[model samples]
Target: MTQIAINRPCPPRRRFGLSLLWDALSLHRQRRTLARLDTRALEDIGITREQAEAEAARPLWDAPEFWQK
Candidate 1:
């Protein structure tokens, strides 16, 4: 006799929404940290303070393109 296999169900809407919210919050926190970093640390990371500030100024909804999927 042959046997059939079952696949897992897709994720629920609530989980996906929560995950997106959490990612946005995390990005906000990271940008806040970047904004708070000293000039020396920014230089060590190869970014100028102005650049860091510019990136940090972006809104939470401005996530990476890959994250859109």
Candidate 2:
């Protein structure tokens, strides 16, 4: 006996939406990590405490436009 398999393509709009969702989630995680970093760590990254705070304060969906692409 033989089995057959079928596959369906995902719509472009849905794919784009999923991409955006992923970007938002990634941004959220990164920001959280940034918020937890110590002053030394922030300094190592060359970002001041105020800059880190500002980045952490931004909404999850507030990523740069190029990130969506």
Candidate 3:
């Protein structure tokens, strides 16, 4: 007798709206602008360059699906 593996459904691919892409890009731009600010300026906004970098590094698909509304 021959043994065969059972077929399985493929995992869904990640999808994103244009708005999500824009939001992530905007976040990146905001991070860059914030980084250019002096330390004191960043402190006034309650954010640091490290924090901004973290935000900018987030995936575009990470944006909320607010556009679905």
Candidate 4:
């Protein structure tokens, strides 16, 4: 045959990398939302505006400690 298509599962390394990227993006979006929360909302969440700003300012690649393991 001149050519034939083959199906294969994603490689482990590539899957891990893609998963990491997705997690980082999700964190970025969540942090943005956190940063926009009003005073009441921040109070409801038990975090101050300063704390939210600090979290929002973090780099995307800086995943939470729990996520590292």
Candidate 5:
């Protein structure tokens, strides 16, 4: 009996562009939810309606730096 070794091809790595798209979509959804929150709900989270509005007004791809990680 003889032992044999086989080499397999590695799968392709995911492109960074896909992650960016996903992040943008997530940001859009979060902003929409934030915009829909009532003043009372916003207050509970210590955020003013104007602040929420400002955040929601940002572009989908304008996510915070931390999100890139």
Candidate 6:
């Protein structure tokens, strides 16, 4: 097998603190907005109230870091 070197630049890393903060705030706002939506509106989006709540409860930093294998 031969190894090749590419000159492509790596993508910028996301700031964890900022990412976490933004995601948390977004989740909070989304939850509030979603709760106000009627069942018909939620059905149009193909998501249930339970699903939205669960998603909002997930930690923003749960994904693996892009730089890690």
lDDT to native, each model: 0.87, 0.84, 0.68, 0.87, 0.86, 0.69
For each candidate, give its TM-score against the true structure: 0.73, 0.69, 0.43, 0.73, 0.69, 0.50
Query: What is the alpha-carbon lDDT for the whole of candidate 5?
Result: 0.86
How many residue pairs clash per model? 0, 0, 0, 0, 0, 0
Candidate 2 to truth, TM = 0.69
Tens-digit lDDT string for candidate 2 (1-69): 999776887554544677667878888999999999999999999999999999999987688776654
Reference-based lDDT, residue 56, model 3: 59
Candidate 1 lands at a TM-score of 0.73
Compared with the true structure, the alpha-carbon lDDT of candidate 3 equals 0.68
What candidate 2 gets wrong by more than 4 Å, as runs, is: 1-15
- The local lDDT score (0 to 100) that residue 2 gets in candidate 5 is 100
lDDT, candidate 1, 1-69, per-residue tens: 999786987674443677778988999999999999998999899999889999999988788887766
lDDT score, candidate 4, position 41: 100
Which pairs clash in the backbone of model 1?
A: none
Q: Can you rank all candidates by lDDT, best first?
A: 1, 4, 5, 2, 6, 3
Better of 3 and 5 by lDDT: 5
Output the TM-score of candidate 5: 0.69
The positional error of residue 40 in candidate 3, measured at the CA in angstroms, is 2.0
> Model 4 segments beyond 4 Å from truth?
1-15
